[model samples]
Target: MQSAQCSGRTLRFGFFEVDLRASELRKHGIRIKVQEQPFHILTLLLERSGDIVTREELRQKLWPAHTFVDFDRSLNKAMTKLRAALADSPESPRYIETLHRRGYRFLAPITPIREDPAESHANFNHAALERAAASLENDQSQDHPKTGFLLSHPRPPATWTWFSLLLGTSTVLVCLTALFLLRVNHSIALGSSFGNLNPRRSVAVLGFRNLSGDSQEAWLSTALSDWLTTELSAGEQLRTIPSESVARMKIELSLPNVDSLGAASLSRIRKNLGTDLVVVGSYAILGEQSHGQIRLDLQLQDTQSGETVDAISETGTESRLFDLVSRAGEHLRDKLGIRAVTREEAAALAVALPSNTEAARLYSEGLAKLRVFDALAAHDLLLKSVAKESNYALSHAALATAWGQLGYDENAKAEAKKAFDLSANLSRAERLLVEGRYRETAREWGKAIEIYRALSEFFPD
Candidate 1:
């Protein structure tokens, strides 16, 4: 039996006819599988031909007042199956169009072979058209009085005027639609190339959640995210938030489960960190690390819009963790439309890196805290790190920055000098940062600005 909503109607469009009275679909003269859910979705799509049906709308329509775990995944599966049955390709659809991160659109023009007089086609702008139709009916009433006739006196005009007005309005609408499509296309073209990344956008990479049952892997979560931050910072175009700032905010806000933070929490954290984007992800070590694979899932959320702009997932072996981090950073930059930076050796550390993982971790934490203006904690941590390893140049440089921020000019200069003298083997970026701090303390504005400018140009992130 056919559904009562579309009862006694045969809607025909393209090569198909949907006979609502019999609940049957025909291509030429054959019948095919039209499952309950897919059939209903098909009708909904047919109703709103040429307009996007958002995932939220579809969820409400399909699963309203029902319990369904992972509705998004289910919807995607349904769409795939529906497309397969229809012989439609999402990439080059003959009937349906898939809009990324949004919803689906029915592409075919709908035509009713016979009208039920009871059911109206649900479609894009249907309500607007209904309202327009009612307005037209009212204007056609003989009892109505015209207020804005655009004439000094009442006079009869030829039917040509009405035709001309209708034609002009249609032409305007078409032009506007064309302009909108052009803009969308241009945006698609400029977005997410293989190389370009958004240079000015500040990104904060939060700790990736470890779904593996082993508590020992907790440090790996922090370590991997640190590596990701480092990889992204290498591009110069990406300004990755220091891990210290992220940890500070995470502690203060009591956001222990940063992985599951909603948009509100993410936005608050981003605002506190003064970053444009917040990158969060979860990871799982499938089976034993010695035998299985490590999987990473990442999301790039736009702080201003609170919308997830990009999502990337990778699976690989533990030994190639660095490779995954590098690829993640590259994809992140590409998503932001930033030009692949030809970063000079500025990103390398000027000093010999600390060999002790704990010391290195402390340095990273202290530097990140200093980035967020928490000089006291940074100073304490840096002091501890240097006590453990006296020749750690990066730690000393960060300590110097802390001293400068705290108005200890002489102390800052001393630390800066020590850092620079010890930085012969350090990365150029670290050396320049330390040099810039000392120049500022010396009140050499011109020299300081010059160094700062060079750093900015060479190491944008």
Candidate 2:
């Protein structure tokens, strides 16, 4: 039957209709296959609608009071299945809002179709219309002050005014709806050419190739990658895989050491790291270390297509290496088609980056050493990095890792706390990492796990 034929018993929300008497759920007049248990749970949530449906209530309704089962697990599994069928996400729920351990509430606004065709036809904003009509009648009585005159006169000016007001309101609503649809269509046309799009794009910055031919400055390879990754993480639409995670994965996969990655390598990185884009780059530092020129080249590779989607390049003085990194990061972000940060955010980001090239170089090398399990070298390098720029938040965070690796619990906790304190200007991902590290040091496993889970949701690599 057509959705229009659904009686007053039928509940409608969005494109879905629930016919309780028929024990059926239909979306756009097509029946959806929902299991018995999940359907019952859905029904309960729907009946309660705006109110919370507690777990205890659900359990009592689903099973007898005397019955025994793994209630929590069963409820969770049912919810998962129901959400899968609805194509809903627990994190950003559309229809069902989870109340953690308490209960669930249906989020969508529901309308019950009237049994009479005339009433059903007028159901659109019926409540508003009723209120308007009642208010109009009261005003008409107050103005005329003659019930007998109103009864005799079958027509009142207030009646015409109410109709005019309703008509104007409906016209405005129609125009707004049309404009909204036009904007939606325009957005869809401009969204993508390939038609394969994700709400958030995940990217990984592989260790840059050091073409400087300077063994002492080899740290630039990992340093540049980490710096770029951190910079990209500042974007709301981009999820960046941590440089340490990418390095560890590279070692685990036994990937070849090369300047550029092949298709197979890109595919493997995508599969293991869950990254949509891989940034591969090379840098060169010419002339002398103090008065040298640095040229950085970067490529944004689409993992699925194994193609270099875009290339970025920047040149600057070697002494202002961190400035070059920042410029390169901005270039790469533009190439990715991500929105630029606001003025305030840009200022905060500037503060988050290392103030001096020396501190950045030391921190990068320290982070690289720490990833390789050389806690002693990492500790020395990171200590000197902080000594050079004590307010560098990332340096303090890396130092905490070094201390933790060396089994200095007190020192690790102190460093983690310091990092957290300094993370106000850091990127969202960096701030979360600092908070998680601090929680771990404080032995707050639950809070640490929650923070890590949130980070995983944001980055997912």
- State which candidate has the highest TM-score: 2
* Tens digit per residue, CA lDDT, model 1, 130-231: 999887667656344565222344555778779888999999999999999999987777564323534567888887887885765565666577777766
What's model 2's overall lDDT?
A: 0.77
Backbone collision count in every prediction? 12, 0
lDDT of 2 by residue, 1-461 (tens): 23333345778888788877877887877887888898899888877777889988999999887788888657766776676556554445688887756888889887886565567667756988999989878877876667523334455599898999999999999999999999999778756532544558888888777786778878788767876776776756687787777876775565533456779889999998989998887888866753678788888898998998888888887566657777877877788787776677667668777878788888878877766555667788999999999998888888997776554678989999999999987877778989998999899999999999997666543
Worst 10 residues of 1 by lDDT: 343-352
lDDT of 1: 0.69
Best model number under lDDT: 2
TM-score of each: 0.42, 0.54
